[model samples]
Target chain A: MMLLQATGLVAGYGRPVVGPVDIALHRGEVLGLAGPNGAGKSTLLAALAGSVRCFAGSILRAPGVALSWQTQRQPAVAGIPLNGRELLALTGAAPAGLPPWLASRLEERLDRLSGGQLQFLHLWACLQAPAEVILLDEPTNNLDPDGVAALAAAIAQRAAAGAGILLVSHDERFVTATCQRQVLLKGAAES
Target chain B: MNVELLFDPLFLWPCLTGMVFALLLPLCGAYLRLRGEWLAALSYAQMAAAGGLGAMALGWPLALGGPAAAFLAAGVKNVFEEAAESVRGAAYAMLLLAGWGVAVLLAANLPLAERLGHALSDGQLYFTDQGHFFAALGALAVALPALAGLSRPLLLSHFYPDFYRARGRSARRLHLAFDLLVAGVLALATTGIGVMAAFALVFIPPLAAAPWAGSWRRALVLGGGLGVFAHLLAFALALVLDQPYGPVLALLLVALGAGSALLAQGHSRIAK
Candidate 1:
C-alpha cells in the first residue's frame, strides 16, 4: 500500500525553493532523493516532514502514519549530555538492532562520540523510531565504511519490516546499493 | 560567632527561601546552559531590577513591576521571532543597558540610591521582606514541577528541535514557555535575593555540575544540591565572619564551580 504520496508538490522556505515535483512512497520501498547542492533535496524532505510550507500540490499519508526525519546537520550535542541509549529510549525507539559498536557505547555521552559515531547513532535513532515513513538527509555524511555498512543493513532491516524510507544522499554508490528507486531533484528553477 | 542569630526569625525566612531558590534555580540554569541561553538570566534579572526600582519610584509594589518588566522583555524576544542572531544579541545588550540606565536614573533622586543600587546588583538576601519571600516560594512551587514535567521535551528541544518538531511537538512554544519560566523565576529572585545572587545561583551551580555529570538529569540534580550546599555554607560563613550574605554566597558559589571544573578535569585525565 502507498504509505505517502506527494502529487505535484511545491514546497519552500519562502519564494518556492523546490518542487511541483511528484513522488509516491510505498510500504517496504526505499526511495533515494539525489541532487546537487541548492537543488532543494533537504527542502523536499522538509516538505515530506511537514516542516516547509507546501505552496502547491498535496501530500497524502496513510491514516495514522507517523514520520521520522533526520536532518542533514548534526544536532549540536556539545552540552546536551544525552547518551545513545537514552536518546533511543526517549524517542521510544528500540535498541535491539543497533550496530554492536554503537550498542556497546550507548552509555557514552553524545558529545563525546566521534563525528562518524554520532552520525550513525542519530541515523539509528530515526530508523528505529516507530514510524511508517522515515526521511533521512545526507545520512552517510561523516560515516566510515563500517558505519555505512551498518546503516545500509539497518535500512534494509527497516524496509523488511514494511517501513517506507525517503533517503536523500549525494553518495551515488550508497544510494545505488540501498535504494530500490531514486528521484533526482533539480534546482527549483529547473524544476 | 553569634550562633543564635542563625535561628532568629529574620534569618529563618531567608534561609528557607534560599533553600527553595537553590532547588529550582540550578535546574533552570542547567537547562538554560544546555540551550546556550544562560545570558537570558542576567538580562531578565536586570530588567526585573529596573522594573522594581521604577515601580518603587512610582509608589507601586516592587513585585508587580519586576515580573511584569521581565515578562515584557521575554515577550519582546518572542515578538522578534525573525530577528537575526546579531539583532537579538544587540536587543539583549540594549535591554540590559537600558534597564540599568533607567534604574540608575530613577534612583538618582532617592536618598539611598547608591545603597539600593548596591542591593539590587550585589543582593541583600537577609533584607528580603515577607512578600518577596512568599513570591519566591510561589515561584518555586510553580517552577519545580513545571521543570520536572517539561524536562524531557525541553532537553529534546535544546538538542534537536527539528526532531521534536517532527514528533508533532511545538518547539517554539516549548522554548517560549521555558523562557517565560526563567524570566518569572529571575524576576522573583531579583526582588528577593538581588540580581547578583539570582544570576550566581542560576548560572554557577549548573556549570559546576556539568563537567562531572554524564547526563542532563544528573547535572541538574548535582547542580541543585551544590546550590543548596553553597547557600547554607555561605549563610554560615556570613554569620561567622560578620559579612553580607549575598556577595559572600556569590563568591563561594563561584569557588565551588571552579573547584568542580578542576575536579572534572582531573577525573577525565584519570579516566584517559
Candidate 2:
C-alpha cells in the first residue's frame, strides 16, 4: 500500500525553494533522496514531514498513517543528562534490536557519548519508533564507517518490518548501496 | 530580634508565599534555561510588576491586574516568534523598560509612590495581604501539577521541537502553554513578593543546580530545593538583622549559584 504520495510538490521556507516534483513511498520500501547542495533535499523531506510550507502541491498519506522525522541537526543534548535508554523510552522505542555495544551504554548520559555513538543512538530511536513512515536527513553525516554500516542494517531491518523509509543524504555510495530506488532533486531553477 | 514577629500572620503569610514561589519558579526556570529563554522570566516579572503597580494606582485588585498584564506581555512575545533572535531580545528589553517606566511614572503621581516604588524594586514580602497569599497558593496549585505532568514532554520539546511535532504533538501550543504558565506564576509572585524576588527565584536556582545535576529532571528538583533553602535562610537572616528581604534573598541566591557553578567546574576538573 502507498504510505505517502506528494504530487507536484514545491516546498520552501518562504519563496518556492524546491520542486514541482512528484514522489511517493510504498510500504516496506526504502527510498533515497539525493542531490547536490541547494537541491532542497531537506526541504522536500520537510514538506513530506509537514514542516516546510508546501508552496504548491498535495501530500496524501494513507489514512491514519504516522511519520517519524529525524532532521539534519539533532537537538543539543548538553546539560540535559538524559541517557540513551531514557531517550528511547521517551520516544516509545524499544532497545531490543540495538547494537550490543550501543545497548550496553544506554545508561550513559547522551552528551557523554562520542559524536558517532550519539548519532547512531538518535537514528536508532527514530527507526525503532512506532510509525508507518520514517524520514531521515543526513543520517550519515557524523557517522564513521562502522556507524554507517550499522545504520544501513537498521534501515533494512525497519523496511523488513513493513515501514516506509524516506532517506535524504549526499553520500552517493551509501544511497546507491542501501536504497532500492533514488529520487534526485535538482536546483530550483533547473527543476 | 523579635522572634514573636516571626509567628505573626504578617510574617508567616509572606514566608508561606515565598515558599510557594520557591517551589514553582525554579521548575519554570529549568525549562527556560534549557530553551535559552532565561531572559523571558525577568521580562515577564517586570511586566507583572508594572501591572501590579497599575492596579494599585487604579484601586484594582493586583492579583487580577498583574496576571492580566503579564499575559498581555506574553501575547506580545508570541507575535515575535518568527522574528530574528536579536529582535526578540530587543522586544523583551523593551517590555522590561516599558514596565519600569510606566511603574515609575505612575508612582511619581501617587502620594504613596515612594513606598510603592520601593516595593516594586526591593519587594515588601512582609506586607503581603491575604488576597496575595491565596493568589500565590492558587498559582502554585495550578503550576505544580501542570509542570509535573508535562515535564518529560516539555523537556523533549525544548531540545527537539520538530521531533516532538513529528510525533503528532503541537510544539507551538506546548510552548505557548508553558509561556502562559510562567506568566501567571510571575504575576502572582511579582504582586506578592516583588519583581526582584520573583526574578531571583526564577533565574538563580536552575543556574545553581545546573553544574551538579546529571539530568534536567534532577536539575529541576535540586533547583526547587535550593530556592526553598535560600528563601528560608534569607528570611531568618532578615528577621535577625532587620535587613531588606528582597535584596538579602537575591544576594544569597547569587552567591550560592556562583558557588555551585565553581564547584561543578572543580568537580569536572577533578574527574578529568
DockQ of each candidate's interface versus the true one? 0.63, 0.58
Give the per-residue lDDT digits (tens) of candidate 2, residues B1-272. Answer: 76676666667777888888988898888888877778888889888877877888888986667788899888888788767879888988998898888878877888775577678678888888676678788888899898877777877666556678877798667777888999998877876677988899989999888767666567778999999999999988887778889989999999998898788789889988
Backbone Cα, N, C clashes tallied per candidate: 0, 0
Model 1: how far residue B232 lies from native, Å: 0.6
Off by over 4 Å in 2: A189-191, B1-10, B129-131, B167-169
Q: What is the lDDT of candidate 2?
A: 0.84
Q: For residues B1-272, could you state the per-residue lDDT of candidate 1 as single tens digits? A: 78788778878777878778877889899888876667778889999988888788778887788888999888876665457767777777777887888888877877665566677877777876676668788888898899988887876665556677887888778778988999999988886678888899999999888776787667778989999999999988897778988889899998998888788789879989
Q: Measured with DockQ on alpha carbons, how good is candidate 1?
A: 0.63
Q: Per-residue CA lDDT of candidate 2, range A29-72, in tens?
A: 99999888999998888888888888787999999988888887
- Per prediction, the TM-score for chain B is 0.92, 0.93
Q: What is the lDDT of residue B249 in candidate 2?
A: 93
